[model samples]
Target: MKIYETAGFPNPARIRMALAEKNASDAVTFVPVDVMAGEHRSEAFRAKNPDATVPYLELADGTCIAQCTAITEYIDGSFDGPSLTGRSPFARAHISMMNLRAENGLLNAVADYFHHATPGLGPDLETDQCAEWGEKRKAVATKTMSYLDGVLAESPYVAGDAFSVADITVFAGLAFADFAKVDIAEELTHLHAWRARVAERPSVAN
Candidate 1:
């Protein structure tokens, strides 16, 4: 298998962390994509992934899987490690729900704010942008942070006691928020504490 990604990018960082958690970093080849140079918009790269997103997984037989969540699902399943996606039926659903919340409410929201409201990736990539919508999504990101803080206040992890992809998603979302200059209120202590603990995990710290 192969993964085409841009190094150090937020979404790609999620996949890298998953691979580390699975202890399967060597299981596939890492192909770097020059996203800043608009290589993802090129015909060659677009043929492999129509969405032209980074951190996509390519199977040996030539199947391409886009989206960080789906790629992380494949990694959690294929590798022998503590499950990141849940082992039980109910757990799976719960984790999935939480992951979606993190993705849409936090990660994608911050992304929209960065790409639209700010001078994200310069004029070349950000051809069309809506400042109003981006500002709205920024609000959504901040709200999601508070929601996650409340969730952490109750459960040990995002979904439950077990560490799962939902945790990973929220972690990445917070990272993106920091990069986008979004403020995480100090009152969200639970969220802050959880982030500190997660940062120490081998998948992230090492």
Candidate 2:
């Protein structure tokens, strides 16, 4: 397998952390995608992935998979390790629910704020922006942080007992929030503590 990605980006970091958790960081090749150069939007790249998104997975059979959720699902199933998406139907559904929340409420929200409100990727790449909508999304991101903090107050991980992809998504979401300069309220102690613990994990540390 090969992962076409832009290094240090949030979505790519999710795949990297997932591989590290499975102890398969070196199993696949990492192909760099120069997103800033608009390489991902080229006709050649679009032929393989219509979405033209970074951090896509390419199987040896020439099958290309886009979207972080789909790629993470493949990673969780292919590698031998604790499941990132739970095995049982209920467990998987629960994890998926929480994962979507983290992605939509936090990560995507932060991204909206960054690209719209802030001068993201500069004027060349960011052709369109709505500062008002971006500010609205920033509010959503903060609200989601508080919601997750409340969740962490009762649960050890984002979804439940064991660490799952929900936790990973939240970790990456928080990292993105930091880059976007979205202030996480100091009162969110549970969230802060949970993030600290997650940062110390072997997979994330790697």
Model 2: per-residue lDDT, tens digit, 117-193?
99998987887799999999999999999999999999999999999999999999999999989999999999999
Give the lowest summed-lDDT range of ten residues in model 2: 120-129
> What TM-score does structure 1 among the candidates reach?
0.98
lDDT of 1 at 48: 91
Clashing residue pairs for model 1: none
Off by over 4 Å in 1: none
| lDDT (0 to 1) per candidate | 0.94, 0.95
Instruction: Work out the TM-score per prediction.
Output: 0.98, 0.99
